[model samples]
Target: MDKAMQKVNERLTPEGKMDVLSKWEVHTLLTASKERFSYEFRACSLAVLNTGSTEDNAKAVLEQYPDFKIEVIQQERGIKLQVSNAPAQAFVDGEMITGIKEHLFSVLRDIVFVGNEIETNPRFDLEKTEDITNAIFHILRNAKALQTEVLPNIAVCWGGHSINRIEYEYTKEVGYQLGLRYLNVCTGCGPGAMKGPMKGANIAHAKQRITDGRYIGITEPGIIAAESPNPIVNELIILPDIEKRLEAFVRMGHGVIVFPGGPGTAEEILYLLGILLHPKNKEVPFPMILTGPKSSEDYFKQIHHFIESTLGFEAQQKYKIIIDDPALVAREMRSMIEDVSDYRRSTSDAYYYNWILHIDKEFQLPFIPSHENMSQLELHKDQETHLLAANLRRAFSGIVAGNVKEEGILSIEENGKFQISGDEEIMTPLDKLLSAFVEQKRMKLPGSEYIPCYEIVKPRNLS
Candidate 1:
């Protein structure tokens, strides 16, 4: 209860799960926080405990807790986390809060499993397309995210963390409707639109006397520090990267509802459209809807225009745009989920996981948004529509990295902004859309001065 105790030092045990681990798993996890090995485990663990954080800068969070450290202490029955300099908010009355502790263990559980089983195990040749997906399935299965005997009712919500009050309220209303219909909520598990829906669904589930409601949050190591899980999330699963995280959303949810957002949301929109646009997935009855408050109609128009201009009209046919009607959104999704269920049943696919959808290897591969890679992206229109979407998704992803991610922020600071260039047909609309996000102050939280992280090089000819 003193200023010195603000940074907690505690030996914490697992709450419900992850209480036991093998000697090999513990040894492999011991290198987690080492600098040469990467701060992925350390950073993700911090984010799990730093649940109520409002800052979206990963570098700032790391620097804010430079003295923080955690180690795995092996025991006969189980293992314990020797945590020092952890955020005090995660603890009350000198004991770590139950949810945060559980989240922390979930982080540990994933790190150990992924390091020892998936990554080190040669069975998953990540370069192969199907292997990547199978690896994702194994990761989710290991985390117990894919349930048995569950119907098609999970709705994956996508939006920005830096949205306005109106948009946030709209997400909550939509979530409430979904919960009233016995549907669960899945999200990127950050703030703004992601948090709103789960918060709304929690209240509705209580009203309906639903005790086993699931508020699932799927994230990855790269973005978790910047966008920590909201308190409403009862189930949290951390994949290896953003690409896997995106796939997890589509694979787990029966339907997707998109709320208004910035570049990160734009990235997600493009990723989904790219997959659904694939000829192989044309027969798949995946339900996708884009909706927001009436005030956000122009925003939707802007996004729609960008999509049409880039991926062509074919991409526009993939989803519906419903404005200002949460009930209607829920009803449409609930009805469409019946189609999803039927399709899955007919195809003999599992109701909890979408095995029929085809995601190209391009979407599965991790895109490192370095300066050279960002500049070399083939953002022209001569390629396949889905391929074009994949590039655009990467472009926005790079911009997102430079905006808030630690590595991207450091790259920007060291080498200046990333340079994104392509044909005028793609660059012009792309520039317009990005500029609008900057103008609306969607790139960063309110009261923070937004800066453009990448320069759009508009081509004069088809070069």
Candidate 2:
């Protein structure tokens, strides 16, 4: 079979996890793969099957394999996937790669479970913040992400998938140091920074003869096609939405290390900052460090300036900044994590999840990145700093959607750039920071020119 034109057909059985499903679960999955929910399920399945892709364009990937089809067939023994026209790259000697097969079943498991148990069930009142948090907890618990007896050793790394070589290498160095200390890694589970950390940690774990090091990758539907799970992700999870994905990262990880990135990274930074700055979370011992290689010194400077100018110095004090030193970054985070563990033990909070953290409804509710919402964002200093951070985070989230998500890309193509207007005080610094990202070529995958999907404007009242 020609690698380009020849498509392989196969029946894949779950080899690792999620092998068994109830009759109802299997029926729901079968329905989801049909016409009603076909697009969502197919898109996610395609992403899982097309792992190792370097291209970040979701639309292009789908178009490239227009004939690809996946069906959930109920068998006498169990459920099996009937996949036709899948990417030839996913196969080795005509057999689907073992890891990709596992991921495909995991996607089926999550989509069916979430659709039936969370979306359609009346018990989960997503309107209530606590209920929403409970739903997230249940999802993670169902995935077996929360291990109560385990110490707090997971470090969530956030950065741009379109990072430079230097920045990517720095992320690996930090991950190596973290692994040397027996810390596991959790990332958004895509390329560049996300892949680098896991790659580095795997080697460190091997060196230490640690067989069970976890490389957890948490993502969502909207962004999954573009940022498909990197092969290094041993534990893959698909959250219902980006908001839940962000929450899962904070809840599941012991600490966070942010590297130089674009708007997505900025959005993650703001999300955590908003949560940490909440009055109720004042005493929480969450460790957050922003670090990068020497070339990224100015990068962190711009980020620091932006945060300070917008959220004030109090938010600035919430996280530490270390430049050009990966070893120290890991050591400092490890030490701070000790404090986190002690706090959790003292407060009777589980080491696996940060149950005591107060996440307001504002942070929990999903923010639709529509043009009107972007235009009406309250990016002024009138509200509490945390509230302001939430809005700012939404602003960046819109940019992220416009940059990579398929819906946002189509919206931009049809409606033109999203209009984002706010107080000049905020807009000025925000614009500067965004401009720096584009100028640094951090907006899109390397060699692909970035077209601005959002136009920053002055507030109407001020104008």
Q: What are the Cα lDDT values of the candidates?
A: 0.89, 0.89
| Pairs of residues clashing in candidate 1 | none
Q: Tell me each candidate's TM-score.
A: 0.97, 0.97
Cα displacement (Å) at residue 440, model 1: 0.6
Q: Give the TM-score of candidate 1.
A: 0.97
Q: lDDT at 372 for candidate 2? A: 82
Give candidate 2's root-mean-square deviation (CA, Å): 1.4
Q: Residue 153 of model 2: what lDDT?
A: 93
What value does the lDDT take at residue 280 in candidate 1? 98
Clashing pairs in 2: none
What 10-residue stretch in candidate 1 is worst by lDDT?
Answer: 29-38
Encode model 2's per-residue lDDT on 257-289: one tens digit a residue: 999889999999999999999999999989999
RMSD per model, one decimal: 1.7, 1.4
- Clashes (N, CA, C under 3 Å) per candidate: 0, 0
